[model samples]
Target: MTTTARRGRPRGEGTDARILEAAHELLLERGYDGYSIDEVAQRAGVAKTTLYRRWPTKDHLIVAVVAKIQDDVPVTDTGNIRHDLVTYLEAIVAGLDRMRRVGRGREPGDRSAGLVAEIVAAAARHPDVGQAVRAVFARRNALPLALLESARARGDLNPDARPDVIFDELAGAVYYRLLITGEPFGGDYASRLVDQVLAGARTPSPRAERS
Candidate 1:
């Protein structure tokens, strides 16, 4: 059988996959500002109408790609909040490490960072992207929340401690170090964050400290 004839059996399946793949690659390459639907269609080797039939708009297509790449944060009941938090943060740091690899060798102020920032900004304006991003964070936090709750129940966390605020602080530190400060993301940094949070959560009473 000919190549076209053999593969033609799937009909629109191949075209749809191509469109999605093309959109993903172009979005990462050109970002929101530089990407266009027509360009995507051309890259995918499909008609403009075919691309539109699958995704009405570029925003919709980007959202779909983001959803497809969204990953579940792993949860582990390691019996120690510090260990669990460290593990969770390490997973996040690993993701950033991957991004750094992807962004390497690119020009200064290039599309890699610009693309991520644009997508985040766009998510603020687009309800579909916002919802999808929200869902991703929600799922990501499940394990951390469980670890926090377990710590509180075990009297490890401060009685007035707020897990949401704590998690945000921890994440903020890591993000600042990785994205802003250009500091290395490593096990030591993760361990330090866990220690910092734990120190803050320690009971302030001298007696509690002695115990």
Candidate 2:
């Protein structure tokens, strides 16, 4: 008698989610330094081969966990570009804050980048991880980029306003503060950031206005 072996990922199983959930918990508990891929598989109740088949490496698993968390943040295009972008960015800031605090114990006035920095360093250290990181960001960034395009199409933004550039500027500001300046993303930062970027993006040139 001949029997066929099981196929890819099994049928209708929540294995992916289970692994990601376990990874997320372990990452928060141990951070990058202490995080163990083997332990994640055990906690996820999945065979080591199953987890390895999906993520292959710790960096890949970590990136997948980050990507999964990112999907929870919604991007709503309410037609008001300023308000929409502000709201979207504020959600992003909240996500970043959670990542920034991951694995770091409570301390008075803590400002370190924590897990955020670890992910970055991991990407830099491994070429495959770097590629995965870029791919995740590229896929995840499309919604906001599309939102900017819609704004431009609706004349809510200057025709010269480049969505990619605008997005980079907006993203860069917060990242720079977090990674370089150690500035807080609290208070009116999200609103202020939106207003500042929109100041340049919203107004068309005099010639454009006349036309």
Candidate 3:
């Protein structure tokens, strides 16, 4: 069927898909701070009431857009703990690469950094925005959880250490470097981080001690 005909088919799967597509595009284009329900409705060619019926607030719409892009990071069983850790950190680096591209055309660190700052500011003002940000963080932590579990199973983690603690120790360092220090987070950084985490997590082998 023609695209116009399909969009005109009334309330169904296609309409919902179109609305979500519009929201996604707008979110990326304008960021959370500048997005508007009326613009989204116009872009989707749907009524403002329809958009409101689905998402009561901009926070809800932002969360829904994030949900659509959510993907599970694959946990690899590479036998070598260092390798698995590098792989996990590299996945995050890859995501940042895409975000960088999306934030292009603006001044240095203007697009992505500005958008993140705006989201944080919005969260401070709106409880619902804060909740949505928390939800996004929780959803994004799934992959890190898998990596931690795998390390624990392999006896690479200290017996007394909690998974959340380990995750914070590792992932939090990368985040601090990325968001705060604005350092280069390439493959070399990933390797170094893996080495650091492994040093802290792995028990020294008796053979290595003897050597």
TM-score, per-candidate, Cα-based? 0.69, 0.80, 0.70
Alpha-carbon lDDT of model 3 = 0.67
Question: How should the candidates be ordered by TM-score, best one leading?
Answer: 2, 3, 1
Candidate 3 residue-wise lDDT, 1-211, digit = tens? 2444445446676667788778766656776667788998899998777778778778887666555544534557666667877877777666554554454355654424333444556677789888887788787777667767777787877665567876787777766765677665666887787787667666543455674
Q: Roughly what TM-score does model 2 have, to 2 decimal places? A: 0.80
Could you give candidate 1's per-residue lDDT for residues 1-211 as a string of tens digits?
A: 2344535354466776788778866766766657799999898887776667667888778776655544534668888888888888887777665554453266543323333455676688778777876776677677688789888888888877888888888888876765566666656888898898788877563455574
Candidate with the larger TM-score of 1 and 3: 3
TM-score of 1: 0.69
Clashes of each: 0, 0, 0
Q: Which 10 consecutive positions of candidate 1 have the poorest summed lDDT?
A: 108-117
**For model 1, which pairs clash?**
none
**Model 2 collision count:** 0
Q: Against the true structure, whose lDDT is highest?
A: 2
Error of 3 at 194 (Å): 1.8
